[model samples]
Target: MMMKTIKYASLFRSEAKKVHRSKRWKPIFNEPLPIEVTGSTQYQGLAPFDFVVALLQDGQSLPSYFYVHPLTLPRKTRANIARALNKSVNEVQCLELHFDGHNGDHLLVYSSDDDANILYLIAIGTHSDIFG
Candidate 1:
């Protein structure tokens, strides 16, 4: 597997550090949302995905939950993204992906559940699963 770079927001890094220091999972899970994807995310750059990949790509399995400010991505055709993620679009925000150790993963390709295909871009992972 190609190793993608992981760039963490300062706030998230700090929060992670604090959580580590606190010696607990609840604290980490309770952390406020991470930075909003702005200028960088506008270009369809893989940065957002890369960040998530970096966060959980190690041999160990760690679940991560993220929130994205919704963006309408009609231009982001399902076919193209499916080709990229190597998965098929199940519904508006649902797609199937097989990521090495992470199986049965669904990409809320864009977070909004509405019909406009608004991509609120978020990846969720829990104790038994990962959504990156």
Candidate 2:
């Protein structure tokens, strides 16, 4: 799969500024959380990237295009994530974006234990690729 690191801060700031100027609304988060895309092939396209941009622009509203919920993983998977993040299983609670019945691309993310505002983008792929 293709992999690349994205510095989302600049992107988010520009987008947020546009939203603020257009809508005269402040962003929900005081600061945009750091975003890291660990792995993905489809993410090379603009659809997912634009979706994320819109999500940020909306400022924390639960839109129909995505769902924010806890991720349930196997014991081994949980342990691996915990080890990698240097966090306990309980502290490793994850949230994901479920795009409306389109490409089945799952965006896995988790907040940093040290800083709740820091978000880590773990993976983006099909169900099998991400959880299988």
Candidate 3:
């Protein structure tokens, strides 16, 4: 009998860790935008990364050839987020970070459901995190 391939979600745990360590800077804006944090996919439980990428790309309507997912994020750091999505890092107080999409870009979006524990991203940037 042939066996089927099972996708284990465990491998992603480490990738997820990389995101958390990254610092989420406060947006330059004086006020916080009306955004929420979540763990559910914003796109009806489908892939929500695209929506996030759109917002990150200055809210472009066109589709992209790549898939972006959020591995981790801190609170209220949306301004420099564009750089993080691109898998590049920003420096402040001598710190660099990466967005671990498990080999894909990352985005932040809102989820309709409300039972999630982790925060949700509505966009991504060109930043990558390393050693913190």
Candidate 4:
């Protein structure tokens, strides 16, 4: 199966800037959004990467669309996040993170493949740890 690359990483900076610039920045939901899915087209689950993009893009409608799934950040996004956290990209294996669709405090737990049980959590966007 060919994997289609999602460009959410590149958009992260811009989205962050928008969020930082305006306290009242609301996402426009009028545009049709693209969401990725797994398995048969008819029977599929939400793609984690796509879901993150949707969250970063517009979160107003997340309750209707986003869900808890195994989310893997793309290579580019992983690298970007590593840089943001001041971590060495090679030492960080953070492609996978969890979003329960109800929490605003998204925890990005990065596990180092070189070492087991070594986890780092970087909080992004808004919300506290509601998943716990």
Candidate 5:
């Protein structure tokens, strides 16, 4: 009787390939929207920027509600952000993202109402750094 031995590495590789292929097989959003920084110096030249971009790209295949969380900012904070962005307060609905690899850092963003395909990065910082 002959016994066949399975190669674990090959099996793992094949499974990984399947997962990768599936990720690229279909996109939830027909197209990924463009992202723009709203001139907030808080997140400039930071790791969170790269993380957010990747999230936006990968999130195209999944509903944003699955990963992106809605934020309810204080009336004062909303006014502040609106003033900085030169946008009306009513137009600023913030979203929060606690990305990996950045301990305690939060990424804040909002999508443009006029252009749904455009995303605006509002801020990136810890709880105090953002709200305080």
Candidate 6:
């Protein structure tokens, strides 16, 4: 069965709680590169979906970086993103991350229950390429 996509705001809240409670942010290497997760809110960009920045770390003092949340994108777009990242669609969906071939930022893409044809894309990187 397909996993139900929760609200973008709700997911952000849950991730914040998890990060604060566990204080752990593990980086997952997406083949040939390391994708760091951060909770910093200093990112400035316009996204297609509602998103928030959250830090990922093991403690309060050391913050590796920040990651954006609640990215719901379309399947075709997802596929294109997956290919760009040298990843499979399932990997992209399961991990909530995508590499735009530049910079270091954690990106998220989630499906929308209200609109099956739409997928939310959230990230803390420059939106000139994607949004343009």
lDDT of each: 0.33, 0.44, 0.29, 0.38, 0.44, 0.34
Question: What shift in Å separates residue 50 of candidate 2 from its native position after superposition?
Answer: 4.7
Q: Compared with the true structure, what per-residue lDDT tens digits does model 2 show for residues 24-112?
A: 22222122222232123232333443546443433334344456667776677667667756678777875666543233444434333
Residue 114 lDDT in model 5? 28
Model 2 weakest lDDT span, ten residues long: 24-33
Question: Candidate 3 local accuracy as lDDT?
Answer: 0.29
Q: Which stretches of candidate 1 lie over 4 Å from their true place?
A: 26-132
**lDDT for each residue of candidate 4 in 4-76, tens digit (9 for 90 to 100):** 2222343444444544454432321122223332324321343443444433333222333344334455677
True-structure Cα RMSD, model 1: 14.8
The C-alpha local distance difference test score for the whole of candidate 2 amounts to 0.44
The per-residue C-alpha lDDT of model 3 at residue 111 equals: 18
lDDT of 1 by residue, 15-84 (tens): 4444344433432233322334222332223333343343334222222333322333344554444443
Q: Which ranges of candidate 5 are over 4 A from the true structure? A: 1-48, 54-67, 80-88, 101-106, 109-117
The lDDT-based order of candidates, best leading, equals 2, 5, 4, 6, 1, 3
Better of 2 and 4 by TM-score: 2
Tens-digit lDDT track of model 6 for 1-132: 232333333444454344334322223221222224223334223121222211111112212223323455668766765564456776555224333322443344333322232233332222432344
Worst 10 residues of 5 by lDDT: 1-10
The better-scoring model by lDDT among 4 and 6 is 4
Better by lDDT, candidate 5 or 4: 5
TM-scores across all candidates? 0.24, 0.44, 0.20, 0.24, 0.40, 0.24
List the candidate 2 regions with Cα displacement exceeding 4 Å: 1-47, 50-62, 101-116
Alpha carbon deviation, residue 66, candidate 2 (Å): 0.7
